[model samples]
Target: MKGRFHEKAPDDIQVFFPNPESEDPMKDEVMWVTVIAHDAASGAFLGILLNAPRHLKDVQEGDNVVFHLPPDAPLPVAVGMGGERLGWPVTAADSLTETVVRGVRHYRQGRFGHNPPGIQACVGTLGHVLEPSPQDAPADLRALGHFVLARCLAEQYETERAIHHFEEVLRLTPEDEYARMGLLAELSVMVHTSPDELKSGTELDWQERYLKQMATALERIKNPHSLELLGVIFSEEEIKNAAESNPERERKLRRIGAGAFRYKVR
Candidate 1:
């Protein structure tokens, strides 16, 4: 009755339900989960509610269910009456293994799409780093491994390493909007906005118009459709200010467009 639930989604979204007594916990109670899937291609989203133990209790073999949860979200366990399989790490391990093998195969075939499948490979490496898994990975995997690790670090607010990862990703895909925006967002967070950072415009109206245009570009890039293709042109300061001033609206816009948002310089 005291186990955790584990689910993994593509990109940086993973969820775990921890044992009640787990150390360094985030939440105490195992409540209902609401998953929102933002389209990696267009940022359009559709979400669903998941009922804890009860929902998964009926899962059968060969069920084509796409699980969604954070890497560290806690799970629940049921009693014997529910035909529960307790302490079974192999189920999760098998899922992890398949993802890695598939990722490597795709990477070798140059079919890694645009992102190089770091999120999947990172999940495997994360398992090895966290547990004593017997995954025989190679040295070259380190490059992609480091990329995902850096993204994880960034999501956790580790500014320095995230920036480093963005740089590396940009090296591989020069026109990558995500990496470029990430770098700009982080820089905006660390560095103060200078008047010189603004474009050369003697008139006040011209400066305002320029800032608004930059802000509009930032909003457009938040859409995954625009992001993955040509990245929008904008000043980071204007984007940061817009994001900060309209936090709620911006978040809703981000969920609709994809998961892109300019991190406020807070």
Candidate 2:
């Protein structure tokens, strides 16, 4: 059977399976497979199924088979606060978000030391995901990698670095609403907690200005996904507070939403 995932296998990359064999992956019980070997020349892969296939009747958990990735599959699942994850992690960004959550939980419980080391390790892990290397990184993965790194850096008070990463996401995928909203959330936190942290670095022109960056992001957003729906949860005050009170920009935001938007608010 052809695997219904668009991705061609790369070393250390996992294979995707669409459960229920449906066109709408959102409604299906999907599975992921760990590829043992992939032949780029032949478009074939040797892999062990990581989990039982809910729809692919011939496959069972731990089954080894030779195959080629087929059709188009979903992106690496979104990872963060309230982000949905499926099966085992297929990317480093998935792992980092879990680590960040654990660190936050521990720090809240009087384990103050959990904060620093966790942040440091996350930084190292994320830095490895980037750099002058060639890996089969999708735009979604690249944006998420940068987005998560930006959050970690922001928490560590590395505002400039955080801005650089957020801007990188916008640079990579201008229409990414999560990163856009993330900038808003980060700006809210900075405004309420550490306004002094907002300053310049040797990066994009919009690096130091959260509102400006967000304005640019709003203008450039070409692709909005269901994830943008998460922005609806943000209170008016939270959304209003994130950006400076700019009526023109707010009008533009509303206008954008009017045309095509799953990414309203925040």
Candidate 3:
């Protein structure tokens, strides 16, 4: 699945339905779905079951099911339904930038509340751009996509996944302060802090590699929250040295809250 698999006007998907006929209480029947259209009010997709029910009784082929989009999205391309399906040329679509914005919109909408539905849509839409192997996509959109995905993952404590996405954004723009800050913070976790990131044998811990630029990056952002994050890993002296003589920087650094990593540099 290197590129978009569902470009055809009518996309088909596979979803899990319980197999009522199976003796086991937990067996799931794989069903093929025909996506009809987006339902605006509920944020759920309306699809028709293409398979005749084998384990289901109340519904049969052509029955409708309103489903939440799965987290890994672009609606998985499904088979088993006999028909001539079309594929949209990978290059023919030109709304990628706008699509990225749409993803951000969804992310913001779902970023709050105990349960957020929009996050699913956010991941799916941005994931569409990602599968096309984002290397050739617009840099801003690509970085934005990775950044948003990274934030979503980090909040859930999916540390490694979040690190990978944050790295993606930094790769496109090494000067990305926010992404670097994010990557550094994530790498500070107990597992990664003790090991060198295995790439290129740099012999530099991921935290240190990012920290080499910390002062400059912090200067750029000038947000006190950044000082709070760095305070947890770097020693107070190291932070002060990095802050240099800028009166405001010193002021911010002094206000950094207390906390330190297991490997906090003294």
Write out the backbone clash pairs for model 2.
none
By TM-score, the best candidate is 3
TM-score for each predicted model, relative to the true structure? 0.30, 0.37, 0.43
How accurate locally is residue 212 in candidate 1, as Cα lDDT from 0 to 100?
47
Name the TM-score of candidate 3.
0.43
lDDT of each: 0.39, 0.48, 0.56
RMSD of candidate 2 to the truth, in angstroms, is: 13.9
Can you tell me which runs of candidate 3 are displaced by over 4 Å? 1-93, 190-224, 232-266
lDDT of 2 by residue, 1-266 (tens): 33444366532344444443356766444456555555679666665455665555534554444445454534222111122222223454555444433333222222222457656655666665554222455566566567666766765766556656777887787776667766655543443332254354322223245446446654665555433443442336544543468776454333222121211121
Which digits, one per residue and each the tens of the lDDT, describe model 3 over residues 35-144? 76665785666666667756565445644555555457654422222221121113333576556556655655564323356666766777666744456666766787
lDDT of 3 at 69: 53
Whole-model alpha-carbon lDDT for candidate 3 = 0.56
**Whose lDDT is higher: candidate 2's or candidate 3's?**
3
TM-score of candidate 2 to 2 decimals: 0.37
Best-to-worst lDDT order? 3, 2, 1
Order of candidate numbers by TM-score, starting with the best: 3, 2, 1
Per-residue alpha-carbon lDDT of model 1 for 1-266, expressed as tens digits? 11332345322222333333334554322333333344366322222223334223332221112233333534321211223222122334444434443433333222222334443444344535423323453322333433444455445555555556656655555555555565655443333234354333333443343344335446645657544332432334444455676777454323222123443110
